[model samples]
Target: MSGKTISELTNEELLDKRKKAKNANIISAVLIGFFVGIAVFSAIKKGLGFFTFFPLIFVFMLMRNQSEAKELDKEIKSRNLHF
Candidate 1:
């Protein structure tokens, strides 16, 4: 568990959290893509081009991923290490 209240973790711990978050993002994308593909294909079979859920979901997830990375970057840089 990362008992780091977002303001107490060191650079290495922040980096590790970023890595885990990124991995989770990748997994989410893969699973969502699979399910979305199935849904889109089923819709297409019915002559319907009125579907845009997957893209929206992907963008949302990607944004969350980037946000997490940025937060970690900000926290790590705020330390002002001088070694």
Candidate 2:
């Protein structure tokens, strides 16, 4: 997060950042799906109390990463970098 601004970054740097953000988004989505499955399974098997907290935490982390990726995508788009 503490890096160059959009205007300061070279086109190659922007493309690299965009690619990394895209990969992070994909990985986070897949992890979120996996955690959601675990959460559902736990909820169905139990009464949905303390046991669901672990999966819920993971889901939150994945969601945060997804949001960060989205922000990066917006930055890239705002700079008109296609990658």
Candidate 3:
């Protein structure tokens, strides 16, 4: 994702990146849910503000991670790389 594309990465590096991507996806999903709950609570208590838009950032990150993971999976499959 830095200077290297998925196809440019070595098998070990690809696996490592894939693992990190998956972990980030999980964390992002949890954060999005948490922020959403907070946003709902804040909305009920007061009115819409920063909290309302905060979860959207996490949603974007989750989507980005999913995309990266899918790309990595495709590369891995094309290369026949396995755990």
Backbone clash numbers for all candidates listed = 0, 0, 0
Model 2, which residues run further than 4 Å from truth? none
**Candidate 2 lDDT, tens digit per residue, 1-83?**
35767567777877787788888777888888988888888888996876667888988877766665566677778877777
Q: Distance (Å) between predicted and true CA of 42, model 3? A: 2.1
In lDDT terms, how accurate is model 3?
0.82
Scanning candidate 2 in windows of ten residues, the lowest lDDT window is: 1-10
In candidate 1, position 20 carries an lDDT of 84
Model 3 ranges off by over 4 Å? 47-50
Q: For residues 1-83, what per-residue lDDT tens digits would candidate 1 score against the true structure?
A: 45656677766666677678778778877867776776677577754444545455665665565666566667767776322
Q: Write the per-residue lDDT of candidate 3 for residues 1-83, one digit (tens) a residue.
A: 48998889989999999889878878877887887788788788878888777776777766765777889899999999884
- TM-score per candidate, in order? 0.54, 0.79, 0.72
Task: List RMSD in Å for every model shown.
Answer: 4.6, 2.2, 2.5
Instruction: Candidate 3: count the clashes.
Output: 0
Off by over 4 Å in 1: 1-3, 46-67, 77-83
Range of the 10 consecutive residues with the lowest summed lDDT in candidate 1? 47-56
Question: Which has the better lDDT: candidate 1, or candidate 2?
Answer: 2
For TM-score, the strongest prediction is 2
